[model samples]
Target: MVISRRGLLQAGIGWLPWRAMPRLTMQLDWHLNAQFAGLCVAESLGYYRRAGLVVNLKAAEPAMDVVQTVVAQPQTLGCAEESLILTAQSEGIDIVAIAAMLQASPLALMSLPQQSLTHPRQLIGKRIGVHSDGRKAVELVLYSHNIDPQQLDLVDIPYDKKYQRLSQGEFDAVQCYALDEPIEFAQRSGQVPTVLPLKDYGFDAYSQVIFAPTSLVMDQPQNIQHFLSATFAGWRWAIEHPSTTANLLVEQYVEPDYQNIAYQQASLEILADYVLPKDAPRLGIIDARRWHESAKQLQQAGLIAALPPMAMSVNDNLWP
Candidate 1:
């Protein structure tokens, strides 16, 4: 009697199966920002192929809700700020941060030099034009200086119009990234925006964390390892050869503007300083104390209902 396909599979139960392997598609949050440029570089440079992953680095649009997207597509791994992941976790989302692209936060408050607002306390009673989602940065700065959020008047400002609003005296300061608006403002307008870095103000949250559902981590730990290893190697190469990396970004990832190339290169160097500390063992190692401290501050500021226990938030296994 001829054995049916199912019977043949059962007959050779101890042998290897011939099922087709499933393809994985990871959905990251954004495009070629300084933090994500390394990922793009890795893809273009074939580092992911070397690591046995077929990564498709798609750009996330502004309207896309990453958390919802990740939840909807079980096969896709999502990446974004660690705080966002923490917030999702607090709300019972099953996502976990796998690796950090930036060991330190890059968020900052940018102001005109003429404003001369050197301290956080100086922000009190000022009309601050911050992106609506910048409450965290504002709260962190206020808490660091023992100022109440109620003291400052927060006006919602669109990011594209921030420079114009500040120039027109519509707002005293704007929440921005050290790499983007500050560099653009300085280059185009010859006005150096003073940056009050979040780290210096006791808000040491990690930025650009690699995240995926907890189920994915449990089922495919090797895939996570391979993705991070290649990604980190790409970062190492970018940090060491910023000019070449910037050129790659301009040619492959962005419009070929000479000024944009210069801006991106300088921004990448600054980001490198933040990603790999001089004394740190590896590039993406999370500082637990800093993580806890940031959570505590966020808790005190009433940002989240309660801080998740430290154990659930950070993974020490990510270290090289």
Candidate 2:
């Protein structure tokens, strides 16, 4: 008998039975951008279905409230910045990071060629654009380099407008994912925006964490493990065969955009440095020390009131 992904998940996680195992839904934090290329690969490659998960990939609205949405649907899992998870947990939301979809923070500051802002400290006195969700990451980066947020003016700009605004000189720089906007802008204008990576500045935080309610994890540990294991395998595969994965993304998910395929392939190569660290356990391994350090940095930057104990937020069973 061929067992379905859901059946295996139910068996592994000790769900009541195949009939009792409910379908799982996931909420992503953004549009179908390259940052989520692995998810696209997983979906196209049959990873989610093989794991018995029925994922509903929703379009994220500008005003979407991530915490409220997750709280309302207790069984639903939501992906967002790790700082948001810490913020939610600090507010007693009971969310735990089950798997880290992105092992490194993608947040960075991008500047036009004329500005030549090569370092975080140089961002002082410049008009910076950042999404409200990205404020904590930017603050952490600034704090790590001893740059005072008060010295700089922050403009709350929608992510879509960031590159254009920068091109038009609306802001001196914009905080965005190194993997997406900078590449997109460069492709469109043939001018590569200078990027200052936050991780390089010691404000290391996890981006794109896969999180669900604490009760859900406690009740279905094995299911969570299976989901993460397959998900990690999907990422590893995506990284190994980026062109093929990008082709899958363009073909299966939507009409082929050859430009996007090229962009995604490049982004995947750059992401390899972030996702797979040498001497670490392996790809997608969630480190407790890294989590604690990130939480502490957020606290120090005043993004969170307090750091939740590392034991409370990170679950290591997802790592192979």
Give the best candidate by TM-score: 2
What are the candidates' C-alpha RMSDs? 7.8, 4.4
TM-score of 1: 0.85
Query: What digit string (tens of lDDT, one per residue) describes model 1 on residues 1-320?
Result: 11233432333222122233233566766555565777877888977776666777766766566777887886677777666766777677887766677877777788899996667888899988776445666776787788988899887666666788887888888888775668878886789888877667777677877777878777776666656666787888888889888878887876333437788888888888777878666766655566677677777777777776452332343324
List of clashing residue pairs for candidate 1 = none
Off by over 4 Å in 1: 1-26, 255-259, 309-320
- What TM-score does each of the candidates earn? 0.85, 0.87
Per-residue error for 222 in candidate 1, Å, reads 0.9
- lDDT of every predicted structure (CA atoms): 0.70, 0.73
